[model samples]
Target: MDDGAERIFAALRDVSQSGAPLYLQLKKNIEEAVKRGLIGPGDALPSERDIAAQADISRVTVRKAVQDLVKSGVLVQRHGSGTFVAPRMERVEQSLSRLTSFTEDMARRGMAARSQWLDRGIYTASPDEMMVLGLSASELVSRLSRLRIADETPLAIERATISASVLPDPHEVTSSLYMALGKTGHRPVRAVQRISAVNLGEAEAQLLAVPIGSACLQIERISYLASGKVIEFTKSIYRGDAYDFVAELRLPGPDGQEGEAT
Candidate 1:
């Protein structure tokens, strides 16, 4: 076992006065180790069998403890890989007043940005996509799904759909979908976003490195061109704890009316 694992075992063995469940005790001990820098972020953890054998605890207990930590955002588990400390993330504020791509938004904040391609293909438009992007049943739509990251932190999952006539090849989108659409002279000049508060589902939580049922912001956007033709329909999920959506407000000067609130 590595020194970190040895420290974790020592910490667990030293807890003699606690009345908490074994899993809970181990959970707190492991969390303290993380806080004390015994296990640094991105450091792979020892296997469950190793921890259980060395700590003299049941593997079930170890699993439960690790699961709790994973849900609490203290640890992250990659498929086919051991669990590791979760990466630290700085909270970000985004303006809702302007239309911009994820690349543009992250660049403005001076954060290096990148995307993990989850999907890029041409497929038959779904019913919702048909209505949102004004597509026909027989018409195909280009799909672009990506995990948007800024400064090595996964911030959002963006999935966009556009008519094949407008975007025949989803793979053409390199960084920004808006930029790719601009090449075809079909970029949207305006967009409408519907934002809602929700809990993260299992798939989304895993992708965003948050616990299942963690707070999230679900946004659906429809984009339109200057000619009033719909061009894009996109859905995005953002980590609520790491993002704050801000919009400027104004009151009408000449009439009893309110300004736009995104």
Candidate 2:
């Protein structure tokens, strides 16, 4: 490393030992440095190895710190080059358990919903998909891949798989698939969903305006009709910063009466 780089690394390390987690402290130190004119926006960051050696911390810590900044749109990583600060943008989030469409959810919050359709097509089903929708191998399924937005802020990317027998025309779906299903007497009254945390890939981060490899929420939902038939299966990725899923629970009363209060 050059003298300038070594000095920069030492200064960053000194700033990082302030009782905060190493990664967060590193991020804050760099941002403060930039704000104070120590580094400009387009300036390249010290390599992870270089930062680790100077900081006397693990390379993993440096990588995590850089990745967090990237996810926050504070840093940008150029393949085969290095990491630098990112330009500004907005980030959006949606609750995973809401049984509403992107439009409806956003509207309730006084935001407008928009979509960029990545895919809309019909194809033969995967075994898991077929089993979930109760379709045969010969049956067709419609797939809709969309980036959902509110007030032009990307919230999530949803890839919904539907049984063609349930929804033969994808064009008829203008907004919420849930509402469309209700119109056709196939609306799901209940659903089972799973949630997991993961890091975003380059494509997802670019589309959602988050840093590549940033933490996100992955949700998989299977919604069922009143008759207990699965009507739809959807997979969505939500920005971790902006979303929180809450549920209200109840149990039978002491008198053996079922709880009824909402």
lDDT of 2 by residue, 1-262 (tens): 6655654675686744558898778878777776776666566788888788878778898888888777667677767888875543344444544576667777787777888899888889999899889998999998888999766457789999999988888767878887888898988888889999999999998877787787889999898888999988999998876677777656778798878665
- lDDT score of residue 249 within candidate 1: 81
lDDT of 1 by residue, 223-261 (tens): 889999888899999999899999888866556677654
The per-candidate count of clashes, in order, stands at 0, 0
Candidate 2 wrongly placed segments (more than 4 Å) = 1-98, 255-262
Report the error of model 1 at residue 180, Å: 1.6
**RMSD for each of the candidates:** 3.6, 8.7
User: What TM-score would you give candidate 1 relative to the actual structure?
Assistant: 0.83
- How many steric clashes does model 2 contain? 0
C-alpha TM-score for every candidate = 0.83, 0.64
Q: What would the C-alpha RMSD of candidate 2 be, to one decimal place?
A: 8.7
Looking at model 1, how many pairs of residues clash? 0
Q: Compare the candidates by lDDT and give the number of the best one.
A: 1
